[model samples]
Target: MAEVKLHGFWSSPFSCRVIWALKLKGVEYEYIEEDLLNKSELLLKYNPIYKKIPVLVHDGKPIAESLVILEYIEETWPENPLLPRDLYDRAMARFWIQYGATKCADAIGALYVASEEEKEKAAKEILEVLKILEDQALGDKKFFGGDNINLVDISYGPCAYWLPALAEAVGVKVLEPSTLPKLHAWAKNFIEVPVIKENIPEHDKMTAYSRSAREKLGKN
Candidate 1:
């Protein structure tokens, strides 16, 4: 068995974050793709509380939460060094990461609920969050942590992969080249990284999944 194992859902950006960090650090892991609708007993056993994916099992010890798992990967395998060495720089990165994790995530999550007829309002909120990420957080940086992809970049892992399909499904356009120039360029560059490029779920696969999920949500 591989020393490192990741319990993830293929279409989940959270899962992709863990996957990217592991691959970037050259960590060989056995990925277990979960069916969110029918989570496995192993997943339940590993992450008994949250029971959510992006769980990294190292030497049989499971670590839950994507962001938490990411820091673990950085600490355990510090070869590539995802976070900056400087304390202040690392703190800045962590701040941006945590902010998005709390506020932006809450806004984006509203897209999942169907009965909320104010889709545009939700989209506007999500766009405003991205706007801050671009203007205040990201700016003109090629990546979140300057020239190199760091923990901060890894934290925003889902934006590059799923945002396109999400925009399509929801009838919105947030990550567009014209709308968010710097961010759009960053997304392109972020995905081009070899570690990320190899492990991302196929576009068609994710789009199909998103559409299906939306349909199910619409019915209820």
Candidate 2:
């Protein structure tokens, strides 16, 4: 048995991504919550350069970056496979994972501000990107890896868990059933998965935190 520990912010999608991966693999680990505003000295020291949460400390060695951490976990546990077994399929999975990561910041930024015009523009752009995901990546797949969730779904973990709360906080309906039917439905299904369901932050709690963050930033 190896000592496994995680440093993360409870409300962070990045943290949640790692959490979901570990749980999906049935790996035992301890969770250490971090304060983003006042990052722990340990977190900064462990991840000196980035100073980001969701760092996995395994047997005393630290691994940062949620996506990279995910690959490490999948490689370590190997029980429940997150990436596809085929080489090409694996590459495709990684490609989509990176795709989601690139788009998420813009999607989230839209709601992070309070300007009505900016909000609308952000929402529209975000939804447009999301539409491409549904139309191309997800299509009619029940999960990113077919019947079950995979690294691709995990990569988009934040979008599934946090988008609804953000929509409420920003008072918009961007992920509507009509607009992004497949993506919206996939989000619902993804959150309902056992591992993700148990590990996610509470809905109301996230809403409050999101609202407070926006207020602090003078977004409202």
Candidate 3:
């Protein structure tokens, strides 16, 4: 029997990325919940470089980073292919996923912890980023991978869940249907997927945690 283990934090989008990929591939593995506040010895040992969660340990080897782990999962378990078979399509998916990680990810942090005076600017920045995604990356596709969810979709999983939750917690919205009709609709569809819907952190709990984190950041 193949031994697979995943160490993750429930509230982390990066962690969710790995979770979604595993679920989609129908791979059963052990899940170890980490306390980000008090890091576990195994987590530290497994990921000494980053000491981060979402580490996928197969047998005795540990793979760190959400995206890296995702790729590993796709390659290892080829049942439900998260990445495309065509070379060009796979390259395109990687490009967009990198764009999302570099561009969209930080914008989320800025919006989430934006002070009252900075909120408008942060929201505007987020809107611009979302616009790029909608117009260029997403276009009119139901999902990033057309009909079925792909690695690109999983890569941007945070936008489906955390983006809206952070917007609500911050009392400003950047993904309204009127402004980003297609992306907004896509978000709804992304969340409705059985695997995604089942795996995400609860909305109310996330909101409360986000609000608390924002407050803590304000004090520091």
Ranking by TM-score: 3, 2, 1
Candidate closer to the true structure by lDDT (higher is better), 2 or 3: 3
- Specify the poorest-scoring 10-residue window by lDDT in model 1: 111-120
**Candidate 2 on 1-220: residue-level lDDT in tens?**
5599999988988899998998889888999989888999889989999999889999999999999999999999988798899999999888888778778566667557847557888888888888888888899998888999999998887888688888788877777899999988899998888888998999999988888888888776
Best by TM-score: 3
State the lDDT at 198 in candidate 2: 90
Selected candidate, larger TM-score, 1 vs 2: 2
TM-score versus the correct structure, for each prediction: 0.94, 0.95, 0.96
lDDT of all predictions, in order shown? 0.85, 0.87, 0.90
What CA RMSD would candidate 1 show? 1.6
How high is the lDDT of residue 47 in model 1? 91
Q: Record all residue pairs in model 3 with backbone atoms less than 3 Å apart, i.e. clashing.
A: none
Per-residue lDDT of candidate 1, residues 1-220 (tens digit): 8998998887889888898888789899898889888999999999999889978999999999999999888899989899989999889989999987988788777765534476778877878888888998789889998998998888887888787887667666668887789999999999998888997888878877777888887822
Kindly report which residue stretches of model 1 are placed more than 4 angstroms away from their true locations once superposed: 114-116
Q: Judge candidate 2 against the unseen true structure and give its global Cα lDDT, from 0 to 1.
A: 0.87
